[model samples]
Target: MLKLAVCVSGGGTNLQAIMDAIDNGTITNARIEVVISNNKNAYALERAKKHGIQSVCISPKDYESREAFNQNFLAKLDSYQVDLVVLAGFLVVIPEAMIKSYRNRIINIHPSLIPSFCGTGYYGLKVHEGVLNRGVKVTGATVHFVDEGTDTGPIILQKAVEVKQDDTPEVLQRRVMEQAEWIIMPKAIDLIANGRVTVSDGHVRIHE
Candidate 1:
């Protein structure tokens, strides 16, 4: 089985989606082995505990430097023998070492249809606000393999949500998240788990 380690920094709705997918057999041949969070009080930890999964808190504040924190974080993940790393609402800028170690094996769910309103400062409702403010006709979610750049990873899946004329940030965000949890995330993981995805020339190709 492909063992997955999920990292989170918030409420963990996306992590819940992954858990539901695993329980429903949508992600066959894989299991979520651990859920790690950088926030000690993040609700994701409680969610993991409820599901009887291993929950760990490796706050950056606990270490002397960013490198040390990342080292400890990677060590914990390595101890679990994690095959895939999923960043579900995780907020930290991943260290270069972790990025090098996981490479294409790490995946993240962005709140926007990326290469659009995404980067170092764009996250959560901020992305939705940017999309709505830009007067774009459509915006949605992206699930992609993690790379060195912020949300610039090879795209694995995207689901678009039409932006209504009167849509507020909260409204658009709720709608986007609905599609995110139900569509993009599951499809991305399935592609990776089934070996249908490959990264080349900065793009992810889904092979038949």
Candidate 2:
């Protein structure tokens, strides 16, 4: 089984999708071993507890320095011996050490089809805001292997959602999450768990 460590910062809707998929067999050969959050009060922790999964909070504010936080966070992850790390709306910039340790084993679900309304300053509702401002006809979500650069990883899966003329950022965000993020995130996990995903030349190639 692919042991997963799901990290989240706020509402864990994506995490919930993964859990549901696992329960319903949409995703096989993987199990969430732990859910970690930088925010102590994150509802994601609550979700983990309710599901009887091990949950931990390692906020940077609780530690003396950023390095201290990073060390403790990495230590916590090490304790789980998880095979994959899933960033489900985790807002924290992953520590370089963790990235180096996990490498392509880590993956993330971005709010938008990356390279558009992505990168710094474009997270959560901001991504939808950008999409609305640009009046783009299409917006979507991306699940990608996590790299050192922000959203600059090999794309694993992407599903496009149409942008409506009357959509607001909040509404568009919800639609994207429902149509794209929720659908693709779990699909990506299943693909990876079954060894169908491969990275080459900094791009992803999937096997049927």
Candidate 3:
């Protein structure tokens, strides 16, 4: 069985999707061992508690530097014996130490189709706003390995959602979550947990 850890910084809609997938047996051989959050008030923690999953809140303010925070965070993951780390609405840039230690073991879900309205400043509704501002006919979500660069990791899966006229950022965000993010993130997790995904030559190939 694969021990899973989820990190979050906001409302855990993506976290919920993962849990739902696991509950429905869509993701086999994996169990969410812990849910970690940088914000104590984050609703993701509450979701974890509701499901009886172990929850940890590690405030960055408690640590002096990013390296210190990463060390403590890595310790928690190690203590849990986590095999996979999922960033579900986690906002902070993952530190180099954690990135290096986890490597392809960490995955994240980005709101917009990556290489588009993504990277440093693109998150939450800002991504949807950017897509609308650019007048893109379609936008979606990307699940990728967590690399040092922001959302620049090798893509695992992408599902596109139509951008409708008169759509507000909030509306588009919801649509993308329902149509894309919620679908592919869990599927990507399933593929990884089941040993069906391989990363080679800076790309991912899923076995049939």
User: Whole-model Cα lDDT per candidate?
Assistant: 0.88, 0.94, 0.92
Clashes of each: 0, 0, 0
Highest-lDDT candidate: 2
Deviation in Å, model 3, residue 191 alpha carbon: 0.7
| Local accuracy of candidate 2 as per-residue lDDT tens digits, 33-149 | 999999999999999999999999989999889999999999999999999999999999999999999989999999887889889898888889999999899989999999999
TM-score of 2: 0.99
| lDDT at 158, model 2 | 92
- Work out how many backbone clashes candidate 2 has: 0
Whole-structure CA lDDT of model 1 = 0.88
Please identify model 3 stretches exceeding 4 Å from their true place. Answer: none
> Would you list the rank order by lDDT, best first?
2, 3, 1
lDDT of model 1 at position 138: 84
- Structural similarity to truth (TM-score) of each candidate: 0.96, 0.99, 0.97
Please write out the lDDT profile of model 3 over residues 1-208, one tens digit for every residue: 8889999999899999999999999888899999999999999999999999999998878999878887887887789889899999887778888888888999999888879999888989999999999999999999999888888889999999999999999999999999999999999999998899999988999998
